[model samples]
Target: MTLPAVLRSAAYPYRANSLNLFRLILAAAVLFAHSWYIAGRGTGPSLQGENLGGWAVAGFFVLSGFLITRSRLRSTPGDYLLHRVARIYPAFVVVLVVTAAVFAPIALLVETGSLQGYLTTPVTPLQYMWGNLPLEIQHYNIGATLQSVPYPGAWNGSLWTLFYEFLCYLVVWVLGFLAVVRRSPVVVGALFLVSVAVYAALGVAQRGGLDESFALFARLLPFFLGGSAVFYLVERWGTNLIFGVASLAAAVGLIAAIPHWGGQVAAPCLAYGLLSLSAVIPQPGWIAKNDISYGFYIYAWPVQQLTVLFGGAQWGMIVYLAITVVVTAAFAWLSWVLVERPVMLAIRERRAKGSTRSEQLPGDIQPAAGT
Candidate 1:
């Protein structure tokens, strides 16, 4: 086929796109952005006042909003909640525990040469697990474990984002429950515009009675909504070469021109731009099938912290980053294979069985054994 025909084709399977690879790249971006801090080098890079990790996170939220909105729409409320909970919670809890028990203790013993008062320390291992189990990171360090590092006292900087990410999920849940997402495009569009307007009016900071976290949420909301808008917008207009080019151009222009609010404003277009790219970009078969991005993300900061403790950062940026990636990827793989995948697979198996039973119902229920 011709280039024009290829560009026009939306033949990429929407359900099985390489968006996971996009997410993996974003995850890697976060690690790269954080490397400077881990290496005691300071902030790595920035654009439009947001760092690489920040932009990657926005991409994450945007992609999540698109996919999660789609998931919510097709699923029952119970199923939606269950799927969301299962997808995020298990790995999260496991990570919290592993950090407190495994990573923190190792750091503590290396730092002080003993775990002698480890359990009773403020934000103890138990505290770390229980404190963050609710999906909010109430404590950063576990027992003075990170005092000697450059970015001291923070065991895991990455986990904090998970809180906001899950909050975004809850927002979708509420919208789904209210039937707002299904009712009208006008309402959702207007809501998105209003959010953008507020974000533009507020800039990067928040005012009024809104607490910091909620204010931060307001800032992030536009990206999520922008992603949601993409789902509907794409459903209505479809993705093609012209659409892809136009959106990509719009994304670049808006993100570059708008300042402070550019990312939030250009979010839908950015998401679509990436989606278009994903269609053309082929991910490896391994990564395409198993999504270890979440695993990669959750473990990166802590793994970097561990690396720093072990003097890995002294090897310079390239070596440090390679070590962090290699170690974190292993942890991510374990988390995926051992924790995340099993829960999700179980959920799928349960769903399949339920579907089978439902299909075999009414007549198939026929009074059991000749009753």
Candidate 2:
């Protein structure tokens, strides 16, 4: 199909687009973005006070909004919830368990030179495993792990966003249940407006400085809603070359002119740019086959921290990033093949069987002819 034709379709997100590659790149960007901080280099480069990691994460949220909203619309609540759980939990739980039980203890022993202390610590295996699972509002730092690193004592910096990502999933579920998502342009437009208002208020409040939390929800929700709006109205406001170029220009102009609220102001345009770029960009077949992005995202920070622990943070970002990327990508590949893909396939098979059973006619059994 032509690029414009692809963009105009509501089904485009589910089709063969470069979105998978985009996600992989974004995941890599997050790893790269964290290289400096985790290596204790500096705060790192940012746009409008948000780092590359932050921007990449925001892009993730936008893409999630577009795709997940479409998913919710196509599914019943039970199916939707099941899909969400299947997508998120299997790999996540395994990682948490492995990290808590094996890696944390090893790190603690290595750093503190006391297996006894690691075993006896209050924040050891049980606490770390259980607390981090179910919800991420628990101890982010395991006891004495990576404490000697220049960044000092943070185990998984990438995990904090998972909490919010899950929260966004819940938000989409609730909106879908409420029939708000059905309203499409109207509801999504209003949501975008509300997000903008909240963002503006927070920006004014934090004019002197920018806290990651201060305008986070305000900033992210709009991008997400923008994506939703695009999906809902793609047939009417379809992506074309002219539209894509214009939107990109608009985003650039807005950001350059109004750095404080430019991202929010240009969110719709940004969403359009992302969607168009993904649609138009040519990618290799393998880009769509093995999706290791999620694994990379969840695994990169700890690997980077380990790199700092072994190599020392004073090593340039080049060495740290090189080591971290290689290790993390290996782990990510294993995660996709071993854990994620298998679990997802199992869930889909179960759902298909359940659907088949449900479709059977009741009381359709035949009696014996002789009787």
Candidate 3:
């Protein structure tokens, strides 16, 4: 069944509420982790727990896969793309522009000794603006030194993940189209696996060793695949006790194994497990009503960057947690009001208009369709 029909199937709408809560929690986890990074706590048990950020990002991937695939199944490809673009790009571009024009200058002034360095030194400006781009497509550092200017020198690191995310959307769109046309899940799955393998190999090669490569692998493909697995299970079996238990098991395994992987290599696995767990668990009252994962994820890095610039000190865990909550909540509100809500409403309106137009068209003009 196509994703739209599956959603309209009335078999599992409530089940997704649990996943929404999971997303909000995961967003908090990511904020905590990034806060630790900002505080320069790069090692030890405190930071180890913070590794859950990877799990949160992975959960987002899974959510995206499930939701996007479902939508594609229901709508025409053009409509699907339009909806997805509207939902993601407006907020993303706004954030990107703000980070570049406003935050980048401020960060550069703080990091370098003088504002003159921002204009004069090529490296400094490049690094500062690199974080401003939506996807972080340009690598900031080359070899032992930063190739671009390092504005917000130690900030906005989480923006790196968006690159992988945009790529995932494209991959899903192409694979989904192929699946719809070919009527073969096996073919789509096989293509996805091959892409993952190739990217994993490239990550290994670029890093020059297994240990380094593993970190890249953890960041990209595994989390996405984990999400794909969730879509497959939910679509094929429906929401049931058995599949829920298996998802729980997978989540536990991933969490337990993440610490062993070391460095960033453990991140994706942690994300996969947490996301799986969310799928199975019941929604908490707070998050069920106001899920803010997307807000949390996008806002945390910039907030931390600003905090660090203001000389926020590294203290105990409690202090860090307090600061993180304050910053995350503030950004979450902004994201909801300025970014998420407006864009979502616009997309829905456009989709509704398109649907009305299609319905108004003559029945004889419609093409024969099947799924």
Candidate 4:
């Protein structure tokens, strides 16, 4: 089966193309934010503004929750796990290996003054490779020494978000399973709220109230619940203009408040509301039809880091930015073609075979009669 056929048969109601495009645009926003930080532009006045990239990460969490929940609603637990693993881990492993074996060495060589110094340093090539191994399982900052030595001091700084994303996936899977067994949204919501509170408290105690851990958990849990709520609302009330307008308003209010309200509280709220609105609104654009946002999100950081390593910090920020864009676009294209497409095809084939086998089975098959 082709991609189009799989999409057409998908049980979810929203348009994939539109969501994908939104994700890509958010990813670009993230890249720009990171670039600004790297260039020493600070969070002062600029065309793109400061720290908008953090908002983009917020958007990603909400989007992930919305889409992943949508898929879970239509799949068995086994199938859902299969799809999620295929979507995430393969690219993750590939990037981890490349960053460890290829990028880390090149980055070290570029930044260090002497080969002897590089070798003699405690954080040697072997140490760097070992550190990247923890990254495969989401333990970052293990062997990092300096924040800027190799650009993020680790293979990929952006990967920190993936750990949270995977955690969100596990949360959704468990909640979804419980919901299916008990058929109670209230129970699921309660459980989610408690988890968020505990996560928030732990984050605050561990890193003080200033750290991202509390903020991230606080922000993301609501967004995930918001997506689940959207699904519930749509199912119960049906998609209509009134609810659509409310969701749109909520989204707009959230976005407009992001810069002022601060990322700690405002960003996740905005992302959740916007994604909720997006689920209801009709996608109507060429860009929406061919969205590649997730692809852009996961690939842009490493590409930028690599550029910084090779091109030198003295190189113009604009030049580095342009190079990052070009390289990231190429990577995004490849990810869509090689990683996402094949996995999706395999999913479709498996589903089709399962359906066929079930159809072939008879209710009254008399195995004892041996006909």
| Among all candidates shown, the one with the greatest lDDT | 1
List residue ranges in candidate 1 displaced over 4 A. Answer: 1-12, 178-180, 203-206, 355-371
Report the candidate with higher lDDT, 1 versus 4: 1
Query: Which 10-residue window in model 4 sums to the lowest lDDT?
Result: 362-371
Best by TM-score: 1
lDDT of 4 by residue, 89-120 (tens): 66666666555556655655555643445444
Output the TM-score of candidate 3.
0.70
Model 3, 1-371: lDDT tens digits are 45554232223443354655555666777777666656666632343363656545655665555555555555666765665565555655665556655666666555554455444454444454554455543533211221123132433566566656656556666766665523545654565465455554565556676564345534465445444544554565445444455545655665566553332233223333444445456766765645456666666777665665656534565765777678777766776677766766666667676652222111111100000
State in Å the error of residue 264, model 3: 14
> Could you tell me which 10 consecutive residues in candidate 3 have the lowest summed lDDT?
362-371
Candidate 3: segments with Cα more than 4 A from true spot: 1-10, 14-16, 44-50, 101-134, 139-152, 179-184, 195-219, 254-291, 356-371
Flag clash pairs in model 2.
none
lDDT of 4 at 168: 67
TM-scores, all models, native as reference: 0.90, 0.85, 0.70, 0.71
**Residues 1-371, model 1: lDDT tens digits:** 46666555464357556777888888999999988987799888988877788888888877777777777677777777777778788888888889887999899988999998899978788887888888777888888788898999998888777777777777777887665568656666677788888877773345565566776677788887888888787666556656767887997798889887888888888878777777667888998767778888989999999899999999899999999999988998998899977887787778886742112111111000000
Tell me the deviation in Å of residue 367 in model 1: 43
Residue 69, model 4: lDDT of: 62
Descending-lDDT candidate ranking: 1, 2, 4, 3
lDDT of all predictions, in order shown? 0.77, 0.69, 0.52, 0.54
Candidate 1 clashes between residue pairs 3 or more apart in a chain or in different chains: none
